[model samples]
Target: MIFKRKSSATTWQEVLEGCLRRDTKAQRQLYERYANFAKNTCLRYAQNEVEAEEMASDGFLKVFDKIEKYDSTQPFEGWLKRIMINTAIDHYRRNSHKISWSDLDEASQVPYSDSYYKDEHLVNITADEIMMFVQRLPASYRAVFSLSVVEGYNHNEIAEMLGISESASRSNLSKAKAKLQSWISAYVIQQDEITHKHE
Candidate 1:
């Protein structure tokens, strides 16, 4: 009976510990559990699902390759998130970011809704569509927008994370917001037109 319980314990926490040892099977399991989340993270930084998925795969590979460097003392998910963030940065650096930033404030916080209705715009727009739009943004805007809006990082953290000045971080976020608002405005107009036509 004790042996059976011990066996189950080994099967559980042992798996995560295996990741620290760079065991492929354990890493594969971790990847499976977190791949979707990481992919979504990547999507915010990529131009499309295909590219996001590819970046996700690369991030996972990096995690596996650098597992030994991961500190067992820290939360595994946080460590993994850092890897995903780096992967996104790598993608950004490979592309472009022509915009510059200066002193700017974050847009006012929107209250969170405890419940969501299926009829909401979220149903109308796929997460991929939004991600593609974000990816199309210039590199400078992309990181700040994704970090502030999606990942919930503040300007200071964003600046620290990307090694930019605080004002630069704010500026990027501001420009990103203005651009996204324009895109949303256009999308809303298009939807209204379609609805009117259908009616």
Candidate 2:
């Protein structure tokens, strides 16, 4: 469905009030207004578009269910983002059995560092391409990477959220960064070669 640009504050308040009252049209409007934001938030944690769509849909259902709990004084977008992140965590928990997680002992062996990606490589890569590489990471690594790197959550917070130890979170993040560094470097080299061939 085509959605107009974001509504004015007054109009948004009206929509929120209608949603609180369980008005279907208002709910539809709200979904249209924030669907892309919600999906993009989920995509960082999802392996594919289908999984991201599922997480987004589930997050909206929770938002509607708990609309009364939202604080009017705070920004609604922040509130929505938290809900989406929690939903992604919930999704991870449910699928945890299918995803392999490194043990704390093994994780402790990996050193944590964030200086692997060079500025030159990053300057040549688009955000979408970076996200694509993130999506290719192992599920556990992806969760830790996105939470730590993209969402700015510390290892302690990530451990609590994912039911893993802080060491595990650090290890997962370290591995993720290493993998991304390798993939992105290769991608940059390939692109450079293609450009040179044309030259």
Note the Cα lDDT for every prediction shown. 0.73, 0.91
Clashing pairs in 1: 97-139
Per-prediction backbone clash count: 1, 0
Give candidate 2's whole-model lDDT.
0.91
Error of 1 at 191 (Å): 1.2
**What's model 1's overall lDDT?**
0.73
lDDT of 2 at 5: 94
Per-residue lDDT of 60-179 in model 1, one digit per residue for the tens?
Answer: 989888877877788878888889988888776565354344454443232222132133544677665666678878768888888887788887888887778888787777667667
By TM-score, the best candidate is 2
* Candidate 1 segments whose C-alpha is farther than 4 A from its true place: 1-12, 66-75, 90-126
Q: For model 2, what is the alpha-carbon lDDT of residue 96?
A: 84
- For all predicted structures, in order, the TM-scores are 0.70, 0.90
The 10-residue segment of model 2 with minimum total lDDT is 109-118
